[model samples]
Target: MAETNKPTATKGVLSIAMIKKLIGAVVGIILGVYIAGIGVPEGLTTKAMWGMAVFICAIVWWIAEVFPDYVTALLMCSAWAVFDIVPFGTAFGGFSNATIWLLIGAFGMAAAVGKCGLLTRISLYLMNLFPLTFKGQTLALMVTGTLMTPLIPSGSAKIAVLAPFAAAVSDSMGYKKKTQGAGGIFAAMFLSLGCIHPLFLSGSFMCYSVVGLLPKDIQSQVTWTSWFINALPWGITVLVLGYLAILFLYKPEEEKRLASTMIKDQRAALGPMSKNEKYVSVVLVLTLLIWMTEVLHGINATIIAIAALAALLGYNVIDRNTFKSGIAWDAIMFIGCIFAVSGVFSALKITGWIGKVLGPHVAPLLAGNIYLFLAVLCIVIYLVRFVLASQLAVITIFTLLLTPLALKEGISPWIMGFTSFVAINVWILMYQNAQYLVAFFGAAGGEMVNHRQMIKLCVAYMIISIIGLLVSIPFWKLTGLIQ
Candidate 1:
């Protein structure tokens, strides 16, 4: 009867299709105009305009939906070859860069840790450090995340790995999810915080790309030592403050149960790390050592990652299908697309137009008011994710187009780039922006935290963002060697 009673509005059906078509058409038109310009002898093929349009759309698509980010990035690289925007060799150069290898190695290590449940062990071990109040676990988990972020670049994978521990805590506290007001909201917010760790690393994908755009002379100033100087302290400040705000405001329902015995139960299921995980760890550790000591010992990270991924399959740590399940190939494809599109920015002279458009307010926007500028940039980008829907899209659009303009005004593009990431991670306000939100549902049989609760948590997080930015930005400049 309920199935029969379902509304059958033909208009609703029509409207949904229309919305997608309308939006898609606009995207196509924008891409078309830019690509069309590539043919204009003087105006076209300059790589600035056309490459960027594809770059923009691909980023949007990857973020808005479940398409590939890596593929999009690679596509931008491909555009360089197709349009002769840059030497095909130079365009492919980025793929082989040490920073790219760092991403691959770090993620591979994370994957091994996740597969063998090392992260869970670490997570549970950390949980044991606190009083085991639900809040204690939440705070501990968040601290762990902040500690982990500089090392781990894939936010979604990190949160996915962390979710089980959070669930275990929720269960340990004896508070049923959803029935307890905002309990799951604590879960969501903590996950957001944990996912935020990569902001410090020059190796994080967005960080690397943004850093790549900096003037060559300024590049040497950012090394691993310098980036962490700023990021670690700032990340700690935000985590500490965020924990306080969340613990008090989103307090878990007082449980009659005690945690004195919970660790014993958790230990029951905790076994020795699996063999594959150990292999992954070894491979990743060895890889990172090579990457960090590039001056004395240079090893390619991508090759190492690909080799490890292949070796994992051969060794049966993960079978082919399982490996496929683990990697988001679509995202890889999307990254390629973005690379191809970014090529047009160089090909068509579009960047100049974008720069001029943003020129007037450049100085005043960032003129000696760094904190305010970054704060506003974060809030704006965070909100824009509602419509934009992809983290990569936000980076591609804002970083590529607006960066030169901000630089012209004496603003450090690096700082501006950092702000884009700070804003992007605060995706708690809207369901549309975060993969972690979706994971909570899958992990919990379709049950989810309330949107209103998320709103409250995100609102409080606005303050936390400022704290994070303040701690990290100057630290980057001071310590001066994190890239």
Candidate 2:
């Protein structure tokens, strides 16, 4: 047994994935430098060149999954400080942004709602009211998602609250996991979560963050009321179209009865509403009233959210520990990083530079045909979303880049902001969003959904989106959002 010597295995240094990421980082840095050097545009400055390099590297790391998104964000801030691209205070300034605090407050409120079983109780009550037909069941789920949007700013939280109910509904109907009924239910919830965010100012943290990024002059016009008025038509249109698409794509076999009593039983099991639930409900209603009446009160939405969160704690609906644990710190960090990056881009004048480079090329094409330009832009945004992972990230980056171009084309900033927000989230091709993926898998439970079925549903939704954009042009014109 001893005659032949065993060959010694080599101890590896970097794994293949790590090596690829390193190459990606290096290439990204080099590309950024090349862009800086070649950017002989009129408005661009030397500081923007360095900022571009850091921005590119950060994006590469984000796309490669080389590091966590927040970690990449932190690295970008650090790089900006280290390279003298911006001051340390400026780089980390996003942490202090009121929008970040707004998210924390909204998340805390959502946590309290979940903790008190308000979400489940409401969901069950809604399910009880809907007709027993398959379409009725789907509508119930969609309605639940829509109603939850104004309360729960976190999409993932809404999914968390609804996925179990959806599963239970499907199970009660004798539909197995991945069956048509189950898939349809999941799609309905998912699509509702996706489409309803832009409809309300408090519906998504991304909306607030976009507003924060706008210039002070334009910020006044991007109010909660304006956003709702401008975006409601498109949002409702997409919701209806998406619901129909899901039904068409995932037609559940005829289930003669939906077992309405199952949801009723669940509601009964929750017993009477607790005192805490009542308090939280009151607080939520008050918060929503304030949010919706921003025009009358003129109070900032962020302040209203914080005030509601404080009321929750004051009334013991949620304690300090609950509030602390409930807040999604990672999401806060990610949002902070996005705000920081946008701030640095503005400070470094990179946003201006982008306008200079693309203005001439895009200006002529957009001349005398703004709607045609917008239609094309909408399509381009959808295509670009394939590479990005986070809807928030997509909105932050593209909104920053494209807003200038839209402004140069003589479009209203409010219109640009609303359109960009909608375009960023119209993810109809794949479940790129983490929240959507969580909802998908959660609803699937043991039986995973068929990928092909999901794709078909997504394709139908995409077509609806395209048509919705075109049809909404007349509406936007009538509202004077687009002229």
| Top-TM-score structure, candidate number | 2
Per residue, candidate 1 scores C-alpha lDDT tens digits across 281-349 of 676566545444433444444565556656656676665555565443343333333233333343455
Q: Model 2, range 213-288, lDDT digits (tens) per residue? A: 7778878877668777777777778888888887787787766565766766776789999999999888878876
What does each candidate score in C-alpha RMSD? 7.5, 7.2
List where candidate 1 sits over 4 angstroms from the true fold: 1-3, 6-123, 149-237, 244-262, 269-296, 335-341, 365-463, 466-483
TM-score for each predicted model, relative to the true structure: 0.59, 0.68
lDDT of 1 at 338: 27
| lDDT (C-alpha) at residue 443 in model 1 | 33
Worst 10 residues of 1 by lDDT: 334-343
* Local accuracy by lDDT, each model: 0.54, 0.68
Lowest lDDT sum, 10 consecutive residues, model 2, at: 4-13
lDDT of 2: 0.68
- Residue pairs in collision within model 2: none
